[model samples]
Target: MSTATPAHSSAQSGTAAIQSATIETRDWLIAAAAAIVALIALYAVFMDNGSLISATGDYLHEFAHDGRHLFGAPCH
Candidate 1:
């Protein structure tokens, strides 16, 4: 009185596997950290005006300034 096939069992198992899949906390933490780093890099490249790295002298400022000009960002 059983009509279950091998293909039907495999399909059920695949659905179960998909339903069991979960995004762990570590994955979320890594994503958050990456976003933070990207934000910091963007800030350093575009918005930094010696206020962020003032103690390091104008080296970083000039570097970012030149980078801006290279990208045609109009810094002056």
Candidate 2:
């Protein structure tokens, strides 16, 4: 009185596992990229002394001046 079928094979399960791994890897890559970008932005705001964005003149420096002071970054 069994109603089991052989349609769901090991190959299909393997493919599904691979797809799940790929999605997890993609999510990790995205998170890593976002963290790197955030670190760069923090450097520009707190540690950069016009070297990171020298092409943009003093715009970034002036914009983040108060923030730098607030965070004790020694902008002076």
Give the winner by lDDT. 2
Per-residue lDDT of 21 in model 1: 60
- Cα deviation in Å at residue 28, candidate 2? 0.9
What's the lDDT for all of these models? 0.76, 0.85
lDDT tens digits, residue span 1-76, model 1? 1566877888998987776664455677899999999998887787677777669565566788878888766575
Candidate 2 residue pairs that clash: none
Model 2, 1-76: lDDT tens per residue? Answer: 1333344556688899999999999999999999999999888888877788669677788899999899889877
Tell me the deviation in Å of residue 68 in model 1: 0.6
Task: Assess the local accuracy of residue 37 in candidate 1 as a C-alpha lDDT between 0 and 100.
Answer: 98
**Steric clashes per prediction:** 0, 0
Lowest-lDDT window of 10 residues in candidate 2? 1-10
